[model samples]
Target: MMEPETRESLIARLPDHADTTAWLEFVQLYEPLIYGIGRRHGLQPTDATDLVQEVLLAVAQSIERFKPDQQRGRFRSWLFGVARNHSLNKLRSLRGQPQPAGGSEAFKQLDQVAAPTSLEQEFTTAFRRRAFRWAARRVRQSVQPTTWEAFSRTAVDCQSAGDVAEDLGVEIGSVYLARSRVMSRLKRLVQEVSGDGFEAIEGELR
Candidate 1:
């Protein structure tokens, strides 16, 4: 889980330009996911990189006006909508240009792209995968080696709890305890990284 100061900073400072720390943290956490969303939408690597910049620029331009309305939706969902609009704009521009000599096939593939919802679904999946990985890394650093191993063996490697207990020379109950603690921390970390908007996106995906 994030330190209390860090979490508070993110929550309080992310919307306006007042918090450089929070803005940097926000960019570090979401930029890769935004880039991945662009690639999944059939953008070339350079174009995807450009898309990340464009989305972040848009966020910077409009974040002050972004209120967290639980009745309406989540911040991440709003961010996703911005990304989708920018991506489609890029696609339309690309479609209007003459195909490059060697990139016609890529353009053809782009031409066959599915609807915006498909891109949104891919973005959510990618976001979840990145969030879990980031949370697991943070938890691993703070946990005891034995505790982390036990949790990984049982929850990730799919070993039986009994088997993990024996391998670690601990009681089965200890193994269960370790897994539970690690999982709880992981969930908290994911929530911290995703902020207040995660649940709304999760509900839509479900």
Candidate 2:
């Protein structure tokens, strides 16, 4: 397993054409995360896709500014914040447009629409999102391939656990245990990996 220190160093090594390899690495690591958050915000498929692109573009511009402190949370939070902001802007634009048939009523009834969140709050949300991703990825890497596949098929992909068990030719109880094991490890890994930044920030606070 790569140490947090190693990961940090690799992430920070972006200036010397980090664009060449590091950028690819970063995109691979974060694209799914950004896309998932966009979908969560009620964006349509095309809008969600566009939102992810815009979010990645923003991240490309702003990631150099992130602190290494884990306590400040994972970079995911900040990324999510950016995505959330973009999503809201898109929503607002949609709201301002003439309704398409029944669209006005649907939008009007969406009481859940609130003012855009502060950047800090958005960042906090992104941090949780990233932490979950980080934890899940780490657990996937650590476990047996078959077990990881089972967990991913059911939990990550939102497939029915029973269906996954049937496909894997495993008992329902085994499916439950497999999912739990992956989830448990994921929680632990995120806390451990994310704590590095927190520790660094706390030292400064003291």
The candidate that wins on lDDT is 1
lDDT of 2: 0.62
Show the lowest summed lDDT stretch of 10 residues, model 1: 1-10
The residue-by-residue lDDT of candidate 2 on 51-134, one tens digit each, is: 878987776676677774743445545556677778767666778666555555434423564443553454444544565565
Q: Which candidate gets the maximum TM-score versus the true structure?
A: 1
| Alpha carbon lDDT of each predicted model | 0.75, 0.62
Q: What's each prediction's TM-score?
A: 0.76, 0.48
> Across residues 65-164, which tens digit of lDDT does each residue of candidate 1 receive?
8776532356667888888778767877887777666555555655576666787667767776666676688899999999999999997788999998
| Stretches > 4 Å off in candidate 1 | 1-13, 16-21, 70-72, 94-99, 104-111, 195-206
